[model samples]
Target: MAKNELHIALVGNPNSGKTSLFNALTGLNQKVGNFPGVTVDKKTGSIRLEENFDAELIDLPGTYSLYPRRADEWVAYKVLMGADADIKPDMVLLVADASNLKRNLLFCSQIIDLKIPVVMALTMTDIAAKKDIQIDINGLEAELGIPVVTVNPRKNKGLTELKKVLAQASRMNQNLHARDFMNTKKLAPESVEGVQKLFPQLSEYAAIHYLINHENFPLSDLDQKAVEQVETVNKFNPNKTQAEEILQRYTRIRQIMQQHVVEHGPLEKKMFTEKLDNILLHRTWGYVILLAVLFLLFQSIFWLAQFPMDGIEWLFTKAGGWLSTTLPQAWWSDLIVNGLVAGLSGILVFVPQIMILFGLITVLEDTGYMARISFLSDKLMRKAGLNGKSVMPMISGFACAVPAIMSARNIENKKERLLTILVTPLMSCSARLPVYTILISLVIDDKYYFGFLSVQGLVMMALYFLGTFMALIVSYVMKFFIKIKEKSFFILELPIYRAPRWKNVGITMVEKAKIFVFDAGKVIIMISLLLWFLSSHGPGNRIEKVEQKYALLAQQHPAQADSLQKPLSAEKLQNSYAGILGKAIEPVIEPLGYDWKIGIALITSFAAREVFVGTMATLYSVEETDDNSSLRQKMDAATHEDGSKVYTLPAALSLMVFYVLAMQCMSTLAVVKRETRSWKWPVFQFIYMTGLAYAMSWLTYVIFS
Candidate 1:
């Protein structure tokens, strides 16, 4: 609201390079939060236009035109229409894809006609150049009556000019008398005039929107009723008016393009992308290539992350050992070394894997292979009662289910979107990566095939495949029961292949890692400290009795005190408060080859699946004599009541299966409730996912045992 600070809205069509441009301008000074009264993500950032003068840029969700369809699109539409009080931009920075000029211009023209000051940033000029197309930027700007800049956000080109133009435009007087892109008043003069009478400040085009989208606007009851009366009296036809407006805009756009744009000739030969797509998107070869790509992606996660993960584990182990030895023997010392350090290790050790996974996924997205995945999977997705759009959210679920489910908002069909949300959690997210890795290390051999193919890596891939397979199966079954019959279509735009933006991939990796460590780390540390207290202390004087008894036994067998210490610690842990709680649930999970300790982990991990490792770290650290042992080693050495190994193949496999299916994340449940706008779906999600996990885990344990 400062006099010198300008509030600019970044608007564009999907794939118009708007996000990249925002990144170039703002760099690391950005934050994401929800828009007011909606769950759609609103990305805003601060950029310094000059000394002591700054601009706040709001990156609106991509939309093709002012007309809104999805929830996210409506967010952008409202902001541009000046109906959203929370974000009324002083000017609009419209990003347009130069490669698809005609279609992009439709949106540009609409924004221009809104009578707001605009600075159009033309992107994808390289792609346009590939098609032998040329544009006269000055001529286009002159015709459109707005400043235009060609920006290559990937290479950080033309951003200086963009900022300069934005600063100049911010200082200029508002030009309300600029020529309209088309004669919007002619489309529906009576309705436009009536709408303008109620809101005197609206442009002819803005009034047209008020006549049509009044209900969607944030208007009071009286105003809404008045707009309804105007519609009734004028006999306004929203669809007809919109169609006529678009036709008029495009007609004007064609005239402008004829003068300022030139296409050299039809493409004489297939481009590299087209030739490459023939092999990559071949019906027979596409699936094979997709599988091969996925196989490498999974394998690389373990291969690439092993060194860093081991280094992190070693650092934490050394740090814990150093703290334990350096500090005096005391309760707080044990808490610091065994509780906080141990728990933090469990969280940070897997960060390398999380980063690598997201970095690779980003590369796929940047290279545009991700869209091809959707295109290729449409048939199978449709068979599962979903569409191609569902593929993106399901794939995104590999990182986290909360955002993955949020991304489902883009799916147009309500039934399909619901189905996507319900089933996406089945996909193995990065949080489960820690659990999966530790368990696989415990149970699966480190043997390799052909000197490179790791058995452990193959098992990791199998877990992901299992989750995806189940998601499809669940979606197929639920589609019939939901019974909200609506026709669906899969219209996907596959961008031409380009080299991955290494900078963006790196940024994504760092951001995802920070999110994982900071967000998940908080819960892990709290649980670790609490679990430490629970495992160390017992109800009433039971802990004191156990300590006294151990003291007496050690005195009686002074020479054997070292050997007796292990049993003494074990006895205390069994009689502790945590022990009592875990024992209460032992019988329930005992059928799945899990003891009270595992029972305790299962309960606490409901907060977050990754917390399972932190819980184990704390529980085992309480009794561990060797501070140098890693979590995997400590877990592997765990024993049952009969002195049998605790994490046997059956038990490890059962735990992995449970995590793969169980809806253990409370955050995911909360998001589902908000998204569905009801508790009914989240509640059902919990029951069914838990039920399936239990049944499958039990079956795995029985068969393996």
Candidate 2:
């Protein structure tokens, strides 16, 4: 290792401001990937410390303690015990919440006893002050015998001094506790001594952990046998030893707090957060507010993103026209003007909605209301055979299912986690926004019911809720089939409410929008090109024959040339390869009120739901060669051979309902496969969701037609 470079691990309890500190220190210099053999998120970043010294910071998952109740906590334990060589840290940066010192210190003290070089970074001191609490940092540092620094990462405070302290701490020798906090030898002398005989370098705390979880710990066959033998000979009682050790640690922590901390008010001060939570978490009123918040979110997705979406469409339309008139009309020119420009336009127009949605979600998180939402939904989650933690992943599925599925790793119960992963894709992600918006505009009226509420936005909200409702139903059904019998519970911390951090919110919005465009954009453009080729050519001379027929018709009647051109081109599309495939599937989907063109879009959009619009855009651009209208306009004016409208209200609604229930995105399936480590679940997921989509869509069409 370089002298200036070191590896540091960040560990703390949930809602301890650990992630905020990491974000402040790393800013946009971070990368997220999975651990070596696990699906848990591993966040690493580069940090520039004092005097040209740099460090690699790994942000471990926020865990309550080192007892390893969750998979993520086990990752932390493995690294802290120097068992995971790939991620073992040179030093540990333990973050403690000053407002809740007693609970936070329990985990901090455990880290200190691990005998690793460690520094304590105290956070939320300002919040503590609001509660009339004060901490003597110097006194606490002397008591703990480690370097301590105060930092408010949200405000970018104390970071310089923190780096300097870390640099100085790194120069010192390895941290070995000269005085033990709890004399484990007195509590379990034989057990500790027997374990230490095998690994003589084990710290007091490390030895105790081995006593509790030696079976799960990293050890070779021979080493494990020796440890088991020691445990057997020593008559180790893990439950009694763990309880005794924890009580002793808490006793010392209480003494330390009395000496180094001060409280200036009564315990129940009716703080600001409590006052706000009263209204936000009220039994009846809380549900009302949550509904209102969701309504506003969907309303804003349409109200705020409309102008930009229109502007993007107009710009692309003009660009396509310009390119067509300026360049010679050739195959490549057509590809550039029609295929690529049309696809790019379809993708870019949705960026505004994505940015707005993610920005508002980030605000919700920063203000600490997101946790309350999770808390309030725990009842409903339990009813669906999941715990409160599943709510976050389900809500996240509205953005994307890939990460939402990955987020389920924290759920300790195997059955609940698998159920969460299976049904999460049923939530309407942002990719489906374009499809719903276009279809709603095509059939639904824009007039408000009560003069202020948008009828269109209401339909959009209905589509989202429809997805969520079906997810819960599917999960309830799957619960009985997945036989893992572990119990489920929810333990969430509601952090103190604070003003929204606009900087963090802005960064999140930008990053999320970038991922949507670049990641989904790659799949969209490639599918668009493939659809273009498939729709442009047929299996034989049929495509050329159709074109010739159209040319001859236009030649004979020059006055009716413009009127005949669109139908002639539509005829050619019906004979193209894409048209043949769509026609082949048309019989299966006809009961759902879809025609061949809509069928084509459905087939192409399986790569990504958002590609539905691009497929429609390319197909329309091909059929109506002289028409330079926006996608919605073309879709709105579509008519059948007998002059009846193709996209009637019934058909439009059926399409929306189908999309709500369908599992069309291939990326989601890939993620499910990766997470479950089997092809069985993803296959079952696709069949169930698609079956439900088809059945519901058929029923909807039957009722409305």
Candidate 3:
């Protein structure tokens, strides 16, 4: 709002490296927020525009024209029109890719029509140079009557020149020179339907937008004055309308580009990108590579994340032990040490694993490899009645289902986006990681199988594949009833690879870790406390009775009591609050080979999958164990009345199968509601996934029993 820090807005098309440039200039001085009434995230920062001048830089969303097609598109168009808010920019900084000048220039032309004080930031000169595509920057600037500065935004090469040009534009505070700046002069009377006929120049882009009735365009706050003037012209000019006139403006800009821009790109395609895309975008091999990459990604998270996960788990268990013993022995001690401290530590322990996985994903996304995954998966998805744009959202489901479901905005087709939203949660998310990790450890051992693979790794891999396969099958069934034409063409830009930006990757990992720790932590901690209360205190004074009975027996036959302490300890647990709950849930979970304790775990874990590890650790640590025995060994020796071990291989397999299929994450469900803009889809998704998990677990138990 203050010109003391002169506002300079950066505008560009998608993949124009506008964000990278912003990062190069401002670093961490940047702050991200939303434009007033717009969901599009806005990034602004302070950059030295030129010597002795500090400029406030605003980076607008990537868009093709002032004719806004989507929410992201509208934000860019509105910021320039000065309709967004009171913070009108002093200078408009337009960044366009020099390699794609003709396509990029059309957008600049639209901005010119808006009559803003403009300066152009030319980008991607490196790629242009590599391909031997030459352009005279001064020549183009003189022809367009604007100052142009060549920049390699990633390398921070163009900041000095760009800064100088901004200072010059600031100095040229001359009267508005744009002839088109005088707002619309009103069109001749024409019928609403005949308006299109009056504006022949706009026929190309408008006809396409009109046919789809693109809903992404935010028209809620449209200018009434512009609307009335357009309506008057449309009434008489039956042959043309306001929309057409706008399209004609773009056409005139296209003609200008055709005359000045050379057609070298088509003739000599960037051999490097062309050659790489040929294999990466290949019909058959492309899909294989995509699948291979995803499999590797999932596998890497499982294997690489395990060390930190194990170390963190050990730390929490030891800390809980220390707290419980160090405190004075009383109800306050148990609640504070076991309930409060353990509960908080439980959720924070998994931050390490989440950080590791998120770190890997950030690298994949920024390197342009993730887009390729969407490109390869789009074809098979459409056959199953979804769009290629749906692939990114679906893959994101693996991280957390809620945001993945929300990312469906990129999908052009309403039905396809909805269908994608409906089934994405069925794909395994990282929340399921804790469940799969523990169960696989129980059934398959940590060691490699047949000398080449970790047995536990193989099991983890299977669970991920299982979730993915089920998602495709369900989507196929949904397609039979939800009719779609599958007519939209995907415009995917395969960006050239750049070295991984560690700072960007680190920032992403830290942000994601904090979000998951706090967002999911609250639910988990509450569940842990409630569960702690439930297991600690039971009805009819059963726990007091156990203490009384044990003390009396211990005095009468001290040696006998010593030998039977564990079984008596089991009775204490059975009589406690957690024990009764376990019994209550035991009947329902009985068919799955789970005891009342395991039943308690199954119920609490729905808050989050990783909570299972903490819950189990808390329960096991309550009973005393020999100093030499590890938690796993103590668990392996746990027995029923029949002297059979509770955690048999078959039972572990059943639990694994259950967690692999269950829709257990509550935060994921909440996210789904926000993303879909209704409860119908998330409710359906939750029910289907839970039912699927139950049936699969039941079948596994029945077969083993």
Residue-wise C-alpha lDDT for candidate 1, range 373-462, written one tens digit per residue: 888888999999999888878876886776578768778778999999999999998779879988998889999999999999999989
Please, what is the TM-score per model?
0.88, 0.88, 0.79
- Give each model's whole-structure lDDT: 0.85, 0.83, 0.69
Compared with the true structure, model 1 gives a TM-score of 0.88
lDDT of 1: 0.85
Model 3 agreement with the true structure over 1-705: per-residue lDDT tens digits: 323458888888887777777777777767765566644467788887655678888888888766665667767765675545645787788888887777777677666655577888899887777766677776677567778888875677978887887887888873224344112323232322232343343233232232222233333434333334445554434235446655665565566556555446557655776777789888888888888887787678667877886787677778778887787889878887767777777666567656766687678767777678877777789787787888877777786665466557667565777788778877787777757765666556569667898777777778878887877788888878766555566777777765667776776677567666665667667766776677678888788888898889889988797666665666776787766777788878877887777876776676677666655655565343324235566667777768888888778888888787777777677656655557876688788878887788888877877
Rate residue 593 of model 2 by lDDT.
Answer: 77
Name the lDDT value of residue 323 in candidate 2. 96
Model 3 TM-score relative to the real fold: 0.79
Candidate No. with top lDDT: 1
Question: Can you tell me which runs of candidate 2 are displaced by over 4 Å?
Answer: 1-4, 264-268, 307-351, 396-414, 429-462, 514-522, 540-572, 608-652, 674-677
Cα RMSD to native, each candidate?
A: 3.7, 3.8, 5.7
lDDT score for candidate 2 against the true structure: 0.83
TM-score ranking of the models: 1, 2, 3
Q: Write the per-residue lDDT of candidate 2 for residues 344-392, one digit (tens) a residue.
A: 8856877887787778877888889888877888899989988777887
lDDT of 1 at 552: 93
By lDDT rank, best first, the candidates go: 1, 2, 3
